[model samples]
Target chain A: MSDSSSILGSTAAPDREAHLTPAANKLYGLMAEFESPAQIVAAAEKVRDAGYRWWDCHTPFPVHGLDQAMGIRATILPVLVFFGGLTGTIAALVLQIFTNAMSFDLWAIVWVRGYDYFISGKPMNSLPAFIPVTFELTVLLASLTVFFGLLLLNGLPRLYHPVFKSQRFARASDDRFFLVIEAKDPQFSRTKTEAMLQALKPLSIEALDS
Target chain B: MSTLVIDNTWDDPAKRAPLVLNHDRFDTVTAEICRVNEEAKPPMAWYVTFGISLALLGLLGVMVMYLLATGVGVWGNQHPVMWGFPIVNFVFWVGIGHAGTLISAILFLFRQKWRTAINRFAEAMTIFAVMCAGIFPAIHVGRIWVIWWVFPIPNQMDMWPQFRSPLIWDVFAVSTYFTVSTLFWYVGLIPDLATLRDRATSKVKAIAYGLFALGWRGSNRHWHRYERAYLLLAALATPLVLSVHSVVSFDFAVSQLPGWHTTIFPPYFVAGAIFSGFAMVVTLAVPARSLWGLKNFITLRHLENMNKIILLTGTIVGYAYAMEFFIAWYSGAIYEQFAFVNRAFGQYAWAYWIMISCNVITPQLFWFKKARTSIWIMFIASLLVNVGMWFERFVIVITTLSQDFLPSSWGYFTPTWVDWLTFLGTFGLFGTFFMLFIRYLPVIAIAEVKGVMPQADPHYGEEGHEHESEHAFGFQPRRPEDKEEDQS
Candidate 1:
């Protein structure tokens, strides 16, 4: 029974491989495990110089200078957040003014909704009073932008990735630093990429299966 | 081949004190921090405290129900002292909430690395304390059902909450504070939650943690955005913290009352809030560190640093107290002078003295290294500071209300049993939430703690590797005598 099962297992392996598509048969990426962040960073610089677009470095924590090493441009999140804050400030000022200071004229019928009532002898359009809420709203919208902007930019809430299929990828959040050159990269060729990574003297290399 | 000799003097483990002790590895940090959750069974002390907290929370519910069924009169609130315990408690709890934001957001922006150990629990405390703080104003409004009236939503009644009123400003300020703080905290927790999700042994645990993690993979792209978001949130929260308590002060400062009405109130109140908040953090952390076996992570240095903050804020609060008196005298406003005089030596002078002794006098001990480092001293000092902060609010609210310009209306305010119970019950609520937090969540940020370790640096001990390997591998050629002995 054991001999027969072993024979069956041997036969099933090729059958699975044969059933796979060409894209699936090809490696998902070449993942090189570096012993240290500096090693991965140095490797990243070399990879960047070699003009690999679809590649990334993964470390347990963000390594300083790694972004520069990988040649990643600065994100536009700050610009988005700044506009968000500006919108909040303007929106707050308009809301307060329209509600408290300005009268609404609808087809020659003046609505009394924007009643200019005096509060503690202060004018209806008290800009000083408006400042607190304006500041609060500015912060609120800017922070919300920062949060949502991050999620949108990173394309996060992504529950799955091909990288998870590699057994060694789990250590990316622990002790290891990894540089993956995606199969889809223009410069990528299985033998050439493997040889290039091997020349870097990485601790280990794995072909991630999609 | 010329080998690279990396200069690693800056990354030397011996040069810097370890944030995490026992020479922890990355996996060990995860295992240690996650141990409480993995064990799944809390110790007996946790159960006992949690049980007590739940009981107190139940009592608070009962009190609320009773007060709602009757009226605001069920509390000690009366004509002369309408603000009573509810407002005082509101301000006190709100003050307690500030320390968390200060530690997490302010310290983060300042680049204080020590905050990582305690920031998680402190942030949790802020959320829970705000919940407790929020309850008072809602219930204090008497018709808790119509609390939505505070919002600027268009209603058929055609009345907008007076936007100019600082009380209305409070509604915006506090709700905004809660929203921002919760977001900041949850954002920080996401990566840590993913770490927890990956380590979870049970299927149920894995799914639950995984869902909250929002499919975080710790991808480089994700981390880049996360870091940016975190920094912006910290920057945003810093001003929000100062603005929150400043606005809360506006609740009193905008009023006509002698003691409450002052330009100094905003800065004074902000300082007091931070002081009380730090005290509460120390109060919670001391027992928690021992209870959870988290001494190594929440180290003496962290405690000492917190004590130093307490000292600084405590002194500021003291200065504020003196400044109030000097300004009151300098302003030559009879009402202000009377109010200051009455607070220190009037019907409720005992309460004033308690506030002074606890908040001002006791914390001065923290100025000494021995006192700051000593567990017992810090614990007692923290508890006293909490007491002093509570009395400080009471002195501000009750004393001023109890004795106004009209001597005819002046009366001594005394809290009814229900008022005391309700205040005590918030403790239960805060404890219950905190106990649950530590029981389930990663109390210390596992990822953050590991991030600060020496091994996390690529250049750590790079220069010493060859010398260490000689001793470790013993690769020196074996002597001929040793070979002959082996042959014999």
Candidate 2:
């Protein structure tokens, strides 16, 4: 998992082709096109069982059970969002306390602050008045975390990908489903992988170049 | 063969009308929606409307500049009724903003499949309405230049916005609502943008759409995370929808004013917000669906469903009004009794009557199926509801302030030309943004709409001999008999 995460982060940058000569650039992967989401799910299960770590399924919309088929673990986004909400809550409390309730004073020998200021005859550190801002800030941070966390987890903002260079790959976002097994996978062998995918009765198979 | 007796149960699938009509393939769904952006040139009517919206946008800019330069006194705000048109428009637009989030986040959470047809534009409307709503309070601060003081940024002045005040809570609530809503809208747009990117005929168009798509290749892993993020956002936004209007209500309910200070304001304001928001959706959608040639996608069923919501929320709001009066009477508070009585017979009596007739009376027509189905009736009712909601805020703000505890301070509030233009300019600004959005983006969510269609399901029509007839891409060929049934 750590190895895959490292690869996803840096080494597998899509633009690495710019550094290599035309002759040195190798085939990125073999992409098999499937007719339906069911077929792709079946293929994904097969690929997962075959112990191919660097393979992925692509579909027009999310297939209900594809995550299980691909052996993809549940995301850690909720935990991150939880911490974010906690941070927001603490920050709101500290900010409101320091700004509204506590005031600073200078003595003859030393300075002192944190004197409580009362407004509207209400007690200092009014918990009820703090609830709305605390709640709002918590939602704000948690939602922002969800958005950015998804992007980071997906390793997105990848404007170009080698798989996109395949002519048949355009249909992946329209009406077709695809399964791509990259050459970098430990289990990948051109002849064996091609024969294995061929057994799945895919619509077509194409080699994607880097 | 043993005869199978199909039970006619209340939960029977045969009783329901299909959500998607004229069942088509996945490819057709993409082609139909993308064709609007690809093949259909902007019509003369589109150009003319865009032109008018742009002129209005220019007018909005001029009005805002004048308001900032000449000061807030250009409007009708004065002693006793210092909170005038600016606050009225703010609450109105903010209330109008609620329907979009309700339809998008709340409906999405409830597993309402019908939301797919209109959720995209409804979410866009949420973002645009918030933008319009945010403009009012920023300018209403009087000292617009020092608006940053609202934030708790550390400064040499050592002064922070009073945290105990509901007004300060409103700043956090509204800004957070805007940010979360925008994120939800944009995240949903990425897949559809990819669809547009793939279909673009020109290189320039392709790159532009591609950039926004952020290299989305629709990988199942990515979709997994995307779906999770979307669900979390919807969960967060649900409470936010409740909190935003509740805090806005706190702005008034926390005050000592007779009409404004009521425990009922929270639920009352929230209900009114949803009511007005749904009305605005109907008002905009009725013409938009027809004008854009989107009758098939934004079907009459969607309109009927929305009208039913309008009916529901309208009743809730009317009930709240009655309860407010009943509570006032029940409490034996003389001031509260005077506030309610004065509202119906005061100088703003005309506005109060308009509010009741438009909000309570007009939506009751939706009780008849014919009225709900009829486009013209729904359109007129929706417009009336919009006017009623505006007057609702007007009556609440003006009437309460006009007849306060001291008879010496009593005065009628009249909006000046600047006040009227600023309100009109927000409409212009909202319309201008909406027009541009409709032109450039796929207004209906292409991917989400496709997700709801029959073909997208893995188990669609897998029973009996029909299993063999499952065509490629999960699209079963429509037989002549099936076509006839669909037509009937």
The numbered model that scores best in TM-score is 2
Error of 1 at B115 (Å): 0.9
What residue pairs are clashing in model 1?
A: none
DockQ of 2: 0.33
**Residue-wise lDDT of candidate 1 within B1-488, one digit each (tens)?**
14422222133665555566664367767777788777868889999999999999999999999999999988889989999999999999999999989988888877787788999999999999999999999999999889998876666555566778788788888988998899988888887787776666666676677678776766665565667778888889999999999999998898899999999999999999999999999999999888877877888878888999999999999999999999999999999999999999999999999999999999999878889888999999999999999999999999999999999999988899999999999989998999999888989877677767766655557876421111100112333332110000
True contacts kept of each: 0.34, 0.54
What's the lDDT of the predicted structure labeled candidate 1? 0.81
Q: What's the TM-score of chain B for every model shown? A: 0.92, 0.92
Candidate 2 residue pairs in backbone clash = none
Question: Which residue segments of model 1 deviate by more than 4 Å?
Answer: A1-26, A105-112, B1-15, B463-488
| DockQ for all models | 0.26, 0.33
Candidate RMSDs in order:
10.2, 8.1
Residue B115 accuracy (lDDT) in model 2: 82
For model 2, residues A32-123, the per-residue Cα lDDT tens digits are 99988778878987888777888888998887666767777667887888998898899899778876787764345443334365789998
Candidate 2 lDDT over residue span B1-488, tens digit each: 14422211123554544445553677877887776677657767778878887888788899989988999889899888999999999999999999888987888887776788888888889889999999999999989989999997666655678888999999999999999999988999999988887777676677788878888989988887788788888899999999999999999999999988999899999999999999999988888877777766777788888999999999999998899889889989898999999998877888999999999999999999889888999999999999999999999999998888999999889899989888988888898888888888988888777777666666556664222212211112223321110000
B460 in model 2: Cα distance from truth in Å? 2.0
